[model samples]
Target chain A: MEARNIKLEEIIRDENLVYTKTSLMTDKPLSFCPGCGHGVAHRVIMEVVDEMGIQADTIGVAPVGCSVLAYEFMNIDMQQASHGRAPAVATGIKRCWPDKYVFTYQGDGDLAAIGTAETIHACNRGENMAIFFVNNGIYGMTGGQMAPTTLPGMRSSTTPYGRDVALMGNPLKITELVAMLPGTCFVARHTVHTPLAVRKFKKAVRMAFENQKLNKGLSFIEIVSNCNSGWKMTPVQANKWMEENMLPYFPPGDIKVNGEMVSKTAKSE
Target chain B: MAKIKGAIVIDIEKCKGCELCLVACPTDVIRMEKKVNGKGYHFAYMEQPDNCTGCANCAVVCPDGVITVYRKKFED
Candidate 1:
């Protein structure tokens, strides 16, 4: 048994290590709820930064919502923006430090609702920065309030009986709306619930950062995530529900790439 | 042909027991521990280490980013 154990240790040596957590992530444990996509989202973005060897040059602006404490988990230089002002903050940072990479992290409540104007104007002006939008429909941080991205008939604390389209208006397809603007160079909607989807999200994140080097206009990535606690479902159930109900409405795809709209049929799954 | 093998190390203290890793794992190589961790959550562990492909699927889908994967090849 001792010899077998030694053999096992020999096989699991450091040289065989295929993957390890990126140093870009602080040793601090994530404060997000169990199974929340915020943690995964944070990981991929940091992974991209670490892979690009741009940790020192990258600055992240995180606004209010569950990710309000994003600076705590993300090891790079980070700035906190007021509720829904991450894009505007990012623009300021990018303008002052044109040589630096800048990005904003915002939730649906902060981005699609409270900061709609900032988000729109920044995209319209084609700010040379990346915007990472996490749209879980409901406001996960504020005890599950209804957000602008909340789907029709979706139930929330404010809409107990379910959101009435006539009263609540329609869920914002902000990704597509931004894609129509000429300022956005790359626009895509993604999720991080599965392995395949996570890989795609990572590529999108990398592309967003790379666009900054080319002076390409704003790159926006909308990650449709799940709010299990607010939705009163288990983590697994929330992802499934999101795949069924949310994906159909927000639909994952590259809305625009390199300033050209991707045809509907050619959309990547 | 050399035989390929894979293994995984999970940081139990950081695990929130969301179970997404289990769903994302293709080979059923991971399982939740019966005992809770310091956080009182049933953390994930390599239940069937021999079957792992080091594909990093579990690590990718892990919301907590607690899993690390390793792969090795041995001459037969």
Candidate 2:
């Protein structure tokens, strides 16, 4: 009965195998703060990276944020970039090690604010690497400050009275803006808020890495994550905030696919 | 066939007191209590009667390894 449940990998694409042992150990301690979305996102990415069999060739860049310890967590070769320089480092790594898979893990503030320049130009050059951006709507490590994706009227340290559009400016939809660039080929936004979403998110990550494996152009995935401690709300409220305020400003679906902008869910069985 | 009822089982040791699972529960049967667990994080408690459909939304987004759901019946 168990054998029947276990389908052979031969039936699946060599690149699309779903089940596999990951270097992510079961007993290893996770450094992420309790209720932090970075933990879940990291696991998802690690699972896909392992299943895709790219761990040996994959080089990752860790950004400056609550998840900076990512280098210590994932069992892969990685480097720590300055606050928002992950894209630049990733670009350099991809250029020098063209045969290797390159990626950067950045937070909303780091990628959408400080690293926006590097991110913009990387896609402009159509670099063959993936960028995994986590948009949790606030700066977690350096105290809870307003982030590029922080919703208007949301209470934050930098915006104690709530993010005012007239003063602080409207929230920046970073992923969509980057997708507008001509060089970006695969762009998508996903979340781990729901199991169904997690399943779909895995597919998106797999597709992004697949693009890189084939020397395809830049692929970006913006994940709507939760910041439980920083938000001062229970992890439940943080996720609820994402679904209520975030999905509208930063819709959770594929923004671009194969050089074409996809505004809606693709017709897939 | 005896239809099994779905339920949520939380790992108290890993619960970080993040109430995300409580809000995601459509049943509104869960709530955060004022007690901290072994991990020093506030933990949530099942408050509402039996609205839990065991959708596993709570387990899906849990940053901490706290919640798990088991469906009463096996899927085809």
Candidate 3:
């Protein structure tokens, strides 16, 4: 009997792959945790930019946090901003280059906490830029400290006993708050826990970038992600936990779409 | 109906062995290799290639962006 040997290159040449990694990503491996949603979010944004054919004209601002090194992973023109200052940097870049596509990749700790003022004012001023906010409910890079968006009764390094609304205040629904502002044209909350969720997230991200080309006001996309290392749960378990706990407080869907607030009934219907 | 075929190429060194892909694969074609990589983590491998439907669900969910999927099409 003769044994036949097949090479991987031949298989790749012969097969019709429906999906493959995008060139927008860098050769460097992502430094995010194994199950962290930050990588998925980064890939989605890069994929959107790649598909839109704006890699050369796109400029990304990454604030301090776990996503601080996003510039390394996203193969495009990028700038590093101080902690909680991506919006300010993005604003400046967008103002200087109105024709260029500018965006800010931020984390909950940077955007909702110390950068709160910048975030609110950037949207209020209707900065023509896309803001990708990754909300993991905890300070992932700072050893799982409680963030301003940390849900009530959630446990963190700072809130060991659990986040008490009376003591820690309620979770900040910054996405909804931004939706109320007139400057914001698109505001949506999404997750990356499942294939369906990832598809929806990609659509939202693409829409946010499209709105920028329309010269619409700010487009805020809040991705409710999980920090497995911070949460002290396996990646799979953390996703399950997020679906059960975080989804209720931060429901996944568009809070505002195309300058119109999507009512709760409309979201359900 | 024409039979559909799927295949995957994994960057072993890039895989963290998180097993997220294991759960993402709808057809259970993926599994963790017994051999560990340079990072001392088991890498993902195709245990049952024939079962893959080229859904790309595992690639979509992979945080490391290590998996690349391929599908073969047949005319009905």
Candidate 4:
């Protein structure tokens, strides 16, 4: 029992260290709820920036959502965009700084609802920037309201009786719609539920950054994350629910790689 | 032969006690502490660290990003 009392400072040795928090992230604690996916998503993105040696030459656009304060956590040049206007802001940043890596962090509500026009036009014009979309189904920040990406039959604050497809219309599959555009160079959907998923998502982010270096148009990555607080479940339960309900509709895979749509059967695991 | 050993450190105060790492860990190396942290949450700690493989699954899935893992190999 006493062995467990060993202080962290006493046990940490540089030579034996296999993993540590990336310095690219600020020391500030995350504002997300306990067990939310946004924290992991933020870490992976920062880790990729750190690994690519692009921290100094990268600019991020934060949308109006739970992660609106993303700039506070990520130690990089960041711009705060109005609701659903991240793509537009990112476009301006990319145009002004063509050589720098530019990206937008948007929630489903911000990207699919309010900023639909900006998102489509940006993708259609083949803006040389990365778009990181966090799709948590329901709106997390504004009190668990139904969003454009909310699943059918899912119970949200606005749809307490569960979303009726006939009345509410079908949930928007914006990722697939963006993939259909010819301007997108690398379009993929991923979730950060497990270690394997995190690895794949990290690779996708890395590829999106690399695509900017090659001037390969736009790279869009939709990360289907969990909103435990909004979903009315524990962190673990929400992930399980997402796997059973969310992943089926928005399967994690590369929708478009290098300007070509990945076939339905040949989607990467 | 080489014996691989791994250890982890958790910033107990930062931890939200979400237990995501507990589920992600393959070797069952982690367990929740009976004592509560300053936040009154049951934070995670290593209960059976000898089984850890330094796979980093726990750290990768941690929402709070509080866990740090280390590994080393010793000749037997």
Name the regions of candidate 4 deviating beyond 4 angstroms: A1-11, A264-268
lDDT of 3 by residue, A1-269 (tens): 01113333444653476677789999898889888999889998999999999998899998899999999999999999998889999999999999899999999989999999999999999999999999999999989999999999999999999999998899998888989999999998888878888999999989988999999999999999999999999999999999888887888888888899995422411
Which scores better on DockQ, 2 or 3? 3
Better of 2 and 4 by DockQ: 4
Q: What is the lDDT of residue A74 in candidate 3?
A: 96
lDDT, residue B37, candidate 2: 80
**lDDT of all the models against the reference?**
0.90, 0.77, 0.88, 0.91
After the best TM-score superposition of candidate 2, give how far the Cα of residue B68 lies from its true spot, in angstroms: 7.5
Expressed as tens digits, the lDDT of each residue in A1-269 for candidate 1 is 12222244655679988877889999899999999999999999999999999998999998999999999999999999999899999999999999999999999999999999999999999999999999999998889999999989999999999999999899988888888899999999999999999999999999999999999999999999999999999899999999999998888889899999994542446
List A-chain TM-scores for all predictions: 0.96, 0.88, 0.94, 0.95
Worst 10 residues of 1 chain A by lDDT: A1-10
Per-candidate interface DockQ score: 0.64, 0.21, 0.60, 0.60
Residue A192 of model 2, lDDT score = 83
Candidate number of the best lDDT: 4
Candidate 1 vs 2: which has more lDDT: 1
CAPRI verdict (incorrect, acceptable, medium, high) for model 4:
medium
RMSD of 4: 2.6
**Candidate 1, position A173, lDDT:** 83
Q: Is the docking of candidate 1 incorrect, acceptable, medium or high quality?
A: medium
- Docking tier of model 3: it is medium
CA displacement after TM-score superposition, residue A40 of candidate 3 (Å): 0.7
lDDT of 2 at A231: 80
